[model samples]
Target: MSAEKIQIFDTTLRDGEQVPGCKLNKKQKLEIAAKLDDLGVDVIEAGFPISSPGDFDAVNAISKLVKNATVCGLTRANKKDIEAAARALEYAVKPRIHTGIGTSDSHIIHKFNSNKEAIIERAVEAVAYAKSFVDDVEFYAEDAGRTDNAYLAKVCEEVIKAGATVLNIPDTTGYCLPYEYGNKIKYLKDNVPGIENVIISCHNHNDLGLATANAVAGAINGARQIECTINGIGERAGNTALEEIVMVFKQHKELNLYTDIDTRMLTELSQFTSETMGMIVQPNKAIVGSNAFAHSSGIHQDGVIKNRETYEIIDPAEVGVNESSIILTARSGRSALAYRLKNIGFEVTKNELDVLYEQFLEVADAKKEVVKEDLERLMYQFNQTVETKFA
Candidate 1:
């Protein structure tokens, strides 16, 4: 109804840590949580406390330490899990309980062998029970992407009536496309009673490589919260990346959806999560990847050198990345070589470029990447005459 403001719900500690070999200790979790606070997240899904004693301690520590962001603990539709989450969140300045159960037919047949009426009952009870312990309750419908839209609307209505501050609809398996996920959120907005008062959250996985796209689409429709992780590291291909979603919102000004995220800390935060979680971010990954702004090909390098807008939509510095690179290789043309040299105060004529072009080929044969220093060393070695005035 009003201008949309996308809330950032970071699930790095919960789902991101679920990645194989990504276990973080209490201290490590606290370190990450503290950084998440500085990075300006709206809510931090601290951990699933009932999963393990270590998780319980980590969640509790995060609840105590995280002062600005809402510290949240996850629970299943059971008393033990809900109680553990409540206990872990006792120390939080603003605490929240995130509890849910599967609602899709496949999950019902395989995971629970349950019926729709029973799932709705559990969903309502979970939200109510969670609300009893804490004022802030977020109810999730697991596998919601595949759940019946009408039933999903009904479930969301009941949960909002039960005092859910946020409703999370997760494409848990990364199966839903952009159109479907946006419709899911729009369905809830149009059908679910009292939905306008609560935040609509989208949790997407990247198995199909549409996580961030789905998230941005959700925001564009009406969903006001995104459940994301740094570096997009999570169970499978990871959730929507916090950095990617924020940058997308920034780059697309027409969307007009804003988050509390500190834009500058994105790079450092991405590096921390990737290293701490033992997951190496792919170079081609959007936003936080090493090559998100890198240009190696000759034509692309020339365009970027002439005007960043030729190839780049957003400035590299917007996401804390240093600059676009012009990598020198056999594929790189003489224009790129002279452009890079000119930036370093070397003046070279067109004819001189022809002379260095052959030398660059020889240099490329030996070096994997031709750095500026490498070019300098090559110049020193050749001491040859320039066809024109080449650097």
Candidate 2:
């Protein structure tokens, strides 16, 4: 792989399922996992195998089914969790055991009730234990977004020495700004011993709605792997959106970075995950939303009608969504009005359209959008008005 290539680690089956009321059975998870592998994600965090029997089965089954992507299972910093993750991934062709512990003072003081030294010891032991089961071991410093950089680097260096091939620096609370997150990654690169030997993975949350930006910032700084989920769905606000990160890298090649993702599969993956998970994607959501390519304003519609690139940066077809939509609303321009009229089988002269445009706006303002039937009725009424004026 090129050094500039960013690895996409999709955690939809794990973190995404954590959303309240959004649960997928084993079969559904396997189906989505298959699609994710086909979509070209570098790693698929199947689930936290030690959390539930259902999750263990899902990870085990996905491990056997997916042919391309490396199957990963999450575990806490403990013997039982790491052992369960290893057993769950026994059938995987390429298996990764992701294990980690809280490193921030808040988590250390409150969540774990431990000190920095104890956290580092647990982190190193966990990585070593996980590495015993699989060649690829990913160590996540949970809440690294708020952890002291020097201490965080200490834990990372120890884990790397203990055989972690990937170091996951997660914005567990979604607290870091982009520059802060970028600086954190850079600090590790400059401070951590033997850091260049392992992949620096960025796992950011969206509490502040900057997960994607922070992830990009980490990539620009030093991180080579991005951990995200489809539709940005997860606990609380969400995680960095997989579609957003992939599309950003695809659109901005000037950064000299790329992912192995098949950009066309983004929309399909988003729809399947949404349907299976029972979460409705917001219409204005980025990348795969219903309104991502829909234009309703007159100026936007006119620009899109004349040249799609005028209004759209990424082609709708590129993501498997339908073509751009020219919706007629109260704000529509004469060009859009005339275009719609022609499509509905009426070829009106500019003068005739000028008379119809005023009536169209009145009807459009009354409704959210004017339908074809409404437009036909308005055209007939305009013709009658013209006849009366002449008679």
Candidate 3:
């Protein structure tokens, strides 16, 4: 069966840059946008054109540079914001105006100081206003994770009727459990009238570390578009990591879902995002971390050395890394020691290895790690011991 395609709507320039010190200049934003287009994302959320002059310029510049992917500018449910977004995206071959308002009661009461009816009216109006500028409009329910499903569905139905091409249900606060988020998307698909006419998108956050899981759940339950950022950089705990969701679909074929992302560019793009934004990706990040393909445990090293599939579900090369690794430390076992030795041009007999293992432990105990030079010195000393014993 042909796999269903999942549209990757990358919001790195829009949401990921929200990190306090991670702002990129217009030139930097354009550079990243060009790469994101090459990486095969379906849509690039360039920036909120109404936010600042720099943002407006960056969005406009990116709209001109990005060819294959749709260039999008964000806006609030206001006329001025929508107009600014339209003006910023005038150069885009495929321009999209993403505009919406909060739907959850908390946002309605505490944030907007508005009621559900007023919020719904604003949402429909926003979609219609955005549609006047561009043929493709994505309507995001700001904090839909906690919004009432029935009301959310009604809002979605109204927007679809008002000419929304994509309906974004964002876990704005990163608060929903995977099942809860999935059920929310499913509810819209099952309950909303004329929902099948528009693409259902999932925008998740990682405050609870469930953004990727919730996004995948949404996809499994029927969301065709995933809104994510590189390295998951955003407000608070950040939005979903783009690499995580793309790798999830690539690794789990049982779901029968796929994306147009160039898997090999994942690591390079991840690093580029971190570097350009002045943000650091965690060492243990899912797909593009330093340790994603590194193995230190003896058992894991042995398994990986035997066959990468034994310990790694995804190959390092698949994400643009050169190769897998076996880190040597005091915790390493004979198998890892042997593997490292062979790589450095030393092939010892089983009997020789038995003797070497004891001496290696003594050296390992004296240091945190063992390098190839350390191994060579140990082997030289072992040869001397063997010769002396024979004499």
Candidate 4:
């Protein structure tokens, strides 16, 4: 538990697949887990073994196949689920069994129709049962955001005493904001005994799109491990994105926390997940999106042509994206057109430039925006002129 390292626990094969239409077969689950390992996540949460036969076989296969990352299986607060998860993780060199129960009053009263004491007891028993089969045990507090902090502290302490090595606090409903989530972690850090000895992990959802922010805020308040997925794909609005968290750490080096993720694999892996899950990555989504590095405005394009830093912050190559784009559109200027044409290895004489410019404007008028291929075709229509460097 070095302060310099931030452990990444990827649940793409489990929580990510929990979405109804996104349910993956055994082979698909294992394939995703393998890719997650290749991306260098510290823990691979394979699946909830007892949830389904398909999940059981997938977890067992991943536990046997994935070598570097710790293989983990999820369980509820019951002995049957705990034992089933343990059976699934038995083949891994380093296996972790994660088990937990609801600690919040709303969940206990409405969801489970139980009392606080009974919920705490169930969590401790589950963690103890999981510990019987594996050295690594993680206990989670479902919907801890609305749970009374003091009661949550009591449950966490009891589970840790029962041999839980990692205590995961999930914002199950994605209801808490960053400021509140950070304070919650700080509260646990101050209240739970021997908390410093055991790793504290954060599992925030993105129901309100604050999962990544809340997770980073948790780290700032002393949580050491983060649970996430590549493209933020999960139930509801999705979970915190693995790529977003890694890039945030890279950009803010002052935090001094490091992850094992190879940033260069972010895009390829995101594309794979999007394609496999039958989901499309939004064109304007933060890091791995198609428009993440694309600029179209005249002023922005001018600065980008002069110096990339004028309009860009992170280099696209660092995140596995190829390059920034100067998209031509109906509103594009001659300077941007000239810049883009030269980038495609085309030169235009004064007369040819006028003709190409008119043609580009006509094409741009037809479409909302002119992309690289459109510009290439338009340039090809004109006589290739070998001219002096214009930039």
Candidate 5:
């Protein structure tokens, strides 16, 4: 069977900018949007047009700039928000109006001060109104992860009947477990009428750090689109990391799922986004982190030196990195030391290496890492000592 193509709905500019101190100006948003298009994202959620004048302008500009991906603008389940989103996306070749309301009892009762029946009516009306402006209308059932499965199915059915082309089931609070989120999507697929006709999207957050797991689970169950942001930057804990989801599918071939993202651009884009947003990518972050392919432990370094697969599930080059780094730390072994030595133009016998290993450890213990200069100095001293003994 052919692999299923999972649509990558990147909300880097829209949702990611919500992080404090991570806001991007119009030029920055456009730069990222163009890169996102080149990276082969299916949808680029530009911004929430109704939020502010500056946001509206950015979304409008992005609509004109993007060539291939769908330029999307966010809105609430109200006419004014929907109108603003529609106006901002006027120049987009493929535009999407994403509008929806909160569906969970907590949101309905506390946030909206409304009831389920009334919320469903608002959701259906929003979808119908958005459909009038564009053929692609995505209806988000905000906080759907905590919403009762049966009531959630009802809302999805109503919105689909009202001309929604896509149904966005968001774990807005990032509270659902993987199995729970997967079961929720499966429930909708089984229960909601006309669900098969509309695309199912998973918009997950990372509060509990299960956003990627939940997204993958949702896809395995039935969802076709995964809504994520670059570096997982967003409100509170953040949204799912786009790189994480893409690599998840790539590495898990048995899932038979794939995305159009050029994996090689992941590291480059990640750095660009990090720099533009002023949000640093953590060194230990998956896929694009500095330490992702670096091996420091004695056992791990020896294994990687023999064969990359023994220590790394992903090739550094596959994600645009040059190669795996055998980081020379206090824990690095002889194999790792020899590998670094050969790269820097040095070949020593076993006895010579044994002698050097003692010196290397003394230096490693004094510093966090052993750099080329350090090794060169150590080798010079060893050669001097050899010459003195021979003399």
Candidate 6:
């Protein structure tokens, strides 16, 4: 069977910019949007046009710049917000108006100060309003993770009937377990009338560190779209990492799912996004982190030196990385040392390596890492000692 293509809806410029100190100007947003189009995302949520004049201009400019992917603008379940999003996306070849309301009881009561019936009415109105502006209208049920399954299904059904092209089930607070989020999608697939006519999208956050897992779970259960951001930058904890979800599907072929993303651009785009937003990706972050494919431990280094598969599930080059790094730390073993030495033009027998290992440890202990200069210095001293002893 052919692998099903999952829609990658990227909200980097919108949700990601919500992070403190991570805002992007119009030029920066356009640069990222063009790259996102090249990266093959299905949708780019540019910004909430009604929020600020800067955001409005950025979204409008991006709408004209993007070619392949749909340019989307976010809004609340109100006519004013929907109108602003529509105006901003006027020039997009493929434009989407994303507007929705909170469906969960907590959000309805505490956030909106409204009841389920009123919330449903507002959601339906928003979808209908957005549909008038564009053929593609995405209705997000914010906090759907905490919303009762049955009630959530009702809202989805109503919006779909009102011409919603996609249903966005967001774990607004990043508060759902994988199984729970999966089951929620499954429930809607089974219960929501006309659900098959519209796409089901998973918009997850990483407050509890389960955003990627939950997104995968949602896909396995029936969601056809995954809404994520570059480097997982967002409010609070973060959104699901785009690189993580794309790689998960790539690595797990048994799931029979795939995306159109250019995997080789993952590292480059990650670095660009990080630099543009001033957000540093954690060194241990999956896929695009600095140390993701670097091995320093003796045992692991030996395993990787023998074969990359023994230690890495994903090939470094597959994600645009040049090669695996054999980081020389105190924990690195002889095999790792030998590998580094050979790369720097030194060849040694096991006995010679044993002698060098002692010196290598002394230097490694003095510093966090051993660099090429340090290795050259070590070899020079060893050669000098040997010459003096022989003399």
lDDT of 1 by residue, 45-75 (tens): 9999999999999999998899899999999
Total clashes for model 6: 0
Clashing pairs in 1: 348-389, 349-389, 351-388, 352-388
Name the 10 consecutive residues with the lowest summed lDDT in model 1. 380-389
Candidate-wise lDDT, in order: 0.88, 0.93, 0.93, 0.89, 0.95, 0.95
Candidate 5: residue 2 lDDT (0-100): 88
* Deviation (Å) of 44 in candidate 4: 0.5
Worst-scoring 10-residue span by lDDT in model 4: 382-391
Instruction: Estimate the TM-score of every prediction.
Output: 0.95, 0.95, 0.97, 0.93, 0.99, 0.99
**Candidate 1: lDDT over CA atoms?**
0.88
For residue 193, model 5's alpha carbon misses the true position, in angstroms, by 0.9
Residue ranges of candidate 1 with Cα displaced over 4 Å: 1-3, 343-345, 384-391
**What would the per-residue lDDT of candidate 6 be over residues 1-391, giving only the tens digit for each residue?**
8899999999999999999999899999999999999999999999999999999999999999999999999999999999999999999999999999888889899998989999999999889988999999999999999999999999999999999999999999999999999999999999998998989999999999999999999999999999999999898999999999999999999999999999999999999999999999999999999999999999999999999999999998889999999999999999999999999999999999999999999999999999999999999999999999999
Residue 230 lDDT (model 3): 90
Better of 3 and 6 by TM-score: 6
lDDT of 5 by residue, 1-391 (tens): 7899999999989889988898889999999999999999999999999999999999999999999999999999999999999999999999999999999999999999999999999998899999999999999999999999999999999999999999999999999999999999999999999999999999999999999999999999999999999888889999999999999999999999999999999999999999999999999999999999999999999999888999899988889999999899999999889999999999999999998999999999999999999999999999999999999
Q: Could you tell me how far off, in angstroms, the CA of residue 77 lies in candidate 3 after the best superposition? A: 0.5
Q: Write the per-residue lDDT of candidate 3 for residues 278-371, one digit (tens) a residue.
A: 8888999888989999998888988899899999999899999999988888788888899889999899888888889989989988987888
Error of 6 at 329 (Å): 1.6
Look at candidate 1 and tell me the lDDT of residue 209: 93
Model 5 lDDT on a 0 to 1 scale? 0.95
Answer with 4 or 5, whichever has the higher TM-score.
5
Q: List residue ranges in candidate 2 displaced over 4 A.
A: 1-3, 379-391
For candidate 3, give the lDDT: 0.93
How would you encode candidate 2's per-residue C-alpha lDDT over 1-391 as one tens digit per residue?
Answer: 3438999999999999999988899999989999999999999999999999999999999999999999999999999999999999999999999999998889999998888888888998889888889999999999999999999989988998999999999999899999999999999999999999999999999999999999999999989999999999998999999999999998998888999988888888888888899999999999999899988999999898899999899999889977887788989999998888888998899998888998898899899998899989988898898899999
For model 3, the stretches where C-alpha displacement exceeds 4 angstroms are 384-391
